[model samples]
Target: MPAIAMETYQDHFDRPLQERSSLEPAWLLEHRKQAMTRFTTLGIPTTRNEEWRFTPIGPIAEAPFAPAVSVAQSVDQTVVSHVGFADMECIRLTFVDGRFVEDLSCLRPLHAGVITGSLGQALAAHPELLEQHLLASDWWHAHPFANLSAAMSVDGAFVYVPDGVTMDVPIVLLNVATAPGARVANYPRSLLVLGRSAAASVVECYVGTSYGADLTCALTDIHLGPNAQMDHYLVQRQSPTSFHVGALGASISRDGVFSSLSVQIGAAIARNDIYAHMGGENVECTLNGFYLVDGNRLIDSHTMLDHAYPHCNSHQVYKGILSEHGRGVFNGKIMVRQDAQKTDAKQTNQVLLLSDDAKINTKPQLEIFADDVKCTHGATVGQLDSDALFYLRARGIPLEDAESLLVHAFAADVTDRIRIPIVRQQIDETLLARLPSPQH
Candidate 1:
């Protein structure tokens, strides 16, 4: 069969700024104009681009129609109840169809200097913070989808932790796309301003209940103050027929620590981009991700860790499991600037393919401009160990059970890094459910 033409995929690019121009601020209006121009000139990404050469987006280009507007949906309490974290208490914020639902949320009274609310409400209540960190557009212009999201996103969450306050409970953001054919896109922009010595943890869940063609574009921005420590987790389990795109950027100050964990299991086509900058001395950042792809699904994860100051350390490890005709992509880059002496950065990407048709493309890169830095990267793509399978079978385990056990062990390596027990357990169950059954 012949391949589909890119131009026919109008739904991906037909969303012009004028369609929703009236909903944004004057500055945002002007910015959207510029962004639209850039998007029009550049158009959709092609395989010719070095960054996208391995992963073809023709399937996405040929997808039909625009995302659905406002559709009615109800959360299946049974399904929602199945997803829970029991290790620690949290302020649960829920959103259905990309719109905040207060009745479904649970917020506990917090200590001083912590503000959590819908982005729209926060804009009205705390305009100054919004003006400072809402959309720092100058930092990046390579991804046109990011610009498109900034222009069209309607509802999301906003969290701000004031100086000198420690939040013991994790602030959880649950975004659920319930309606089938719902074109719900949200830009959940969070600005974490931790005063010196403050600490907090956050969890973000992206889920879908119905199986329809949906589109989700989410953006999260985090800022860590000096001596602050934060752990951020992003869990995605949308419909298998949906399109998901996300971008996250973090700025770390002196003596700060930032830990990130990303889990991907749903969506027909999903892409996640993360960028972290160590702006202060003695800062440490850890980036970890795990993804599972089955059937014809595709999941892509890209990251960039920038070391700009002295005595900064970073570690990145991403692992994936592919089955059937599933495909996975992982691209990681580490940059050490000239002033970033005494920097230690390491990155690794590994993939395990279960079928002959399954495929994975992985790349790990290190760019060092400092002579006194220690930076290294490695990537590997392979199948499960036949020797290990034989050993399991020799121990009287069934072949299918052995395969499942090995696959789960490989994935558990990453899940164990998750400090939140509730989040870890939820991910474990979701992954097991998505994996191929032992009988298969």
Candidate 2:
């Protein structure tokens, strides 16, 4: 494939980083320039790239790119109301068109040394931590989107939890795009560092107005110190005409526990890249994801799990449901390093298609350089069971209702793994509403 012309998209790419230079560090500026150079050399990924073989970026690259501009329009409360998660009381940080809205947010006072605020505020208040953790990690290789996010991100959230502080209440980061016919782009960056023995749960939600052609490029970096525990969930529900791309990098220390759940149900094109590194012994990690697509929508998930230390365990399971002309992609890779003895890793990917036009491509890969490791990977793609459908019909259940029940049942297997009640309920309701009627 030919390289995409940089002249066509240079205007959209240059404006955001230029306007935010006053706030960004000088070192970061140099890094961004280097990243932009790499982006220019690599251009947009195509079907030929091994990592992106099943997904295509031609449509996104062809679309005229535009930077999100400031607007005075208030966020639609109806859209906000649609974002609640059962009984969970949260500190809601709201962003409209890549800028923070202080008045619209509901932030709870912290009891200790933890700091949770806008990225701009953090840059001024906690420059030391930001200097150490902000885009300084080594996980930013070969990922064009991550590089773009670091170079052009204007606004995002920053979270810091001090040592021994446990936050029981989930912190909610809500990002919404309010303009119609505007090609909006956002880089919602989050830096979460859990000190030794600290614990917390976080929920990140990406939503947009009902009628907008938007784009969101988000990045989250989580660092877990020794004996720390953290649970994270990302729920993406953007406009059907929007595009969403995200990347998550997590590092776990000795005796740390990290769990992540991702649910994607919106956007015309969506892609997610998740990377987990077990850097210490006795660490454990779990990665789970579910995606539902309809119409001409496309969703892709690419994940990597690295066991760099000994006596660690990791598990990953991803499921997808496609209907109409929808398409889905899943790629999971697990690597056990040479010195990482006694490592246990498991991975699985499953898909269910409801129409002949629907398509799914799934790949699960495992690479082990350790002599004493247990690893497994499996992938499956198929449709609903005809015998089960006939059995339900024979039992006098309406076809549509039976189909809904079965679809729900299939998705429930993954949703049940969610540890948070409020988040679990929200996933259930969202899946129930977005799923197609079983009447077909």
Candidate 3:
């Protein structure tokens, strides 16, 4: 089908305007309408499309629309405390389903002129600022999910750091999807803008409380000005029976540095897409990711790095450990334009299979048009080294423990890049907790 009839959502969209937040701007209504129009034009993706050839998204496209569609907002702090990450000194914004929970959020004193709060709130206070950065590319759409997310997003995190300011405290946006008895679909959104000479660290986490088959669709947009630097991380930890699809896009300017890592270890089916546009000179970008899947689960990742300027550098490394019929996919593409001379880029993808049924499909591609640019790509798929396993067994180590140790060490290549100590430890423990049973 070329389009999903508007009749599917017209009634819901025509509801009483008074039901929405009073602070909501009039422009937002039009913004959502445009997004819906684009979504209908794009329709749902299918396996025929090269981008989603291996994904086989029939489960998503054929599933009936989930009801009670309102974002769940009644989750109390007690439940959130148990969902995992230990309490630490930082700025945090909590969301249940897609609803923002103000009481659960804690804020610290930020530098002068720095603004960090709810996106719904920012729309009223700084509409001009949001309009400048939020989806500024007119006459453009990055597939249907991006449009669907824009159409359905209600409240999410918003951050803006002015020039010459530095934020020391890490910023965390915790999203928890809760559905006890029914299946629900939610879309979460975030926008971050950093000015020249600004630096900060941020985290986007998606967690589910129940084992129900919930669906989460998320999108994040980031922009960095000249000389700006930022460290970003995306972590997903939902029930193994749920589904997740998320996308992130970033733009960096001259002398800017953008570092991001993805740690995905949840859901039965998950697809992550990342795109980076380096259009300024002397820019540095790093993309690192780690995924652990087991028990019939699947994880897929697709990344695109485009270098449109000279004197830029990009590095990427992704590793996955799969077991128990679990499957994984990694497709990374790097492009260097003709004008992008003096560019240096490297990409690698590695997978460790713990069982005969576990499998991975990896593709690392490099498209270079610049004669002076240096770009390389590689991918490897292998099981645990018998030499290493035998060495551990020779020391009287239990077979299962030896296997677990090797798996943990295999993950260090990507996990070691995490700068936050607490988050590092959290991922480390979670990795061990989810280790698969030995196939004796």
Candidate 4:
């Protein structure tokens, strides 16, 4: 942590516990206290931190960012229409600056036994449920950012799908940040639970407007019961001057199916940490990610898939495109415990550099303790194929156009993995508009 940033943040963190903990119950207050203590002890991570070695976070630590407060007029209805996925038929819950805006949200005709709304509201309406799940475990205490988010998180999205219930359409959890200016921060926390035999799809989008040099640290916990199935997508499109760090922790039960797609195309320095655990037999997991960065931006993705039971399967693929002086990092690990016999897992990471200055650091690791398990991991980094560019240019394509064509082709594999047509098309267009100019 930078000295000036740390000194400034200490004041931000010194708010009286009573002032921040007034409304919550005793259990929650204690939870916040414990997390706050951990945050103080751990402080901000530096290059010395193994997980943060490749990604330097001095800019974020030095910035004087206080927690975001609610601004009713900051977000209007028009902003939603421009963010894509607006045409989809799904339940929409909107939040601005970490506070849920009930007026801007669209929630109607929800399915039977389904619960979706603000996390703070849910804590009041369904204390028992929130007590059973939110901040109930020590899983998040190990990370400083997650601990800070838990300690300072005021509001976010919450969803609960009862057993045997299947949602016909996806649920959109939209978080918008309209900062009055830079030097502000927002802590967004999400809890999604799917009961036994239930199925649903969820889309979590993080976007910012009129914000320069801001910060957002968000965390999400997804719990799936036995035989439950869930399709999760996390789309990050914050302002180019902002900083973002997000963590996703998931638990899968027996015979449960969980798949996640992560697309990152925004933020000056962005890092995403995803961890999925299979607790029961026959569970299946899939993790896919796509990232595009240029012009000195840095994007880092760290993922872990853990198998604790027998006969489970896991597959992961992450691809990246870096241009100009952009930088990227991909570190993925798959672990199979001794009890996890018959486990099958595979992990791959591929990176494309559009210029000589573009750089990437990739590491894929697999650790298997079970003799019967099969695991493999690999990573590849390379520049655009000159042969392919030449072929396209020979076919009457201009040099710039030919370069874009090859770049698009390199990205096609990841684009085809997206199941939502509108999102796919939107990403296609966004990638083209941001493609780096080919250097002569």
* Candidate 4 lDDT for residue 399: 85
lDDT against the true structure, per candidate, is 0.77, 0.82, 0.83, 0.86
Better of 1 and 4 by TM-score: 4
Query: Compared with the true structure, what per-residue lDDT tens digits does model 1 show for residues 311-344?
Result: 9999998999999999999999999999999999
Q: After superposition, how far is residue 287 of candidate 3 from its true place, in Å?
A: 0.5
What are the models' TM-scores?
Answer: 0.89, 0.94, 0.94, 0.96
lDDT of 1 at 313: 94
Error of 1 at 318 (Å): 0.6
Model 2 clashing residue pairs (backbone): none
The 10 consecutive residues of candidate 1 with the worst lDDT sum are 1-10
Could you tell me the TM-score of candidate 3?
0.94
Candidate number with greatest lDDT: 4
Best by TM-score: 4
Scored against the true structure, residue 57 in model 2 reaches a CA lDDT of 69
Clashes, model 4: 0
Supply the TM-score for candidate 4. Answer: 0.96
C-alpha RMSD in Å of predicted model 2 compared with the true structure:
2.2
Which residue pairs in candidate 1 have backbone atoms (N, alpha carbon, C) closer than 3 angstroms, thus clashing?
68-183
Model 2 / residue 205 / CA error / Å: 0.9
Which stretches in model 2 have alpha-carbon errors above 4 Å?
1-5, 8-21, 85-88, 390-394, 437-440
Q: Write the per-residue lDDT of candidate 3 for residues 14-37, one digit (tens) a residue.
A: 463456536466677677778877
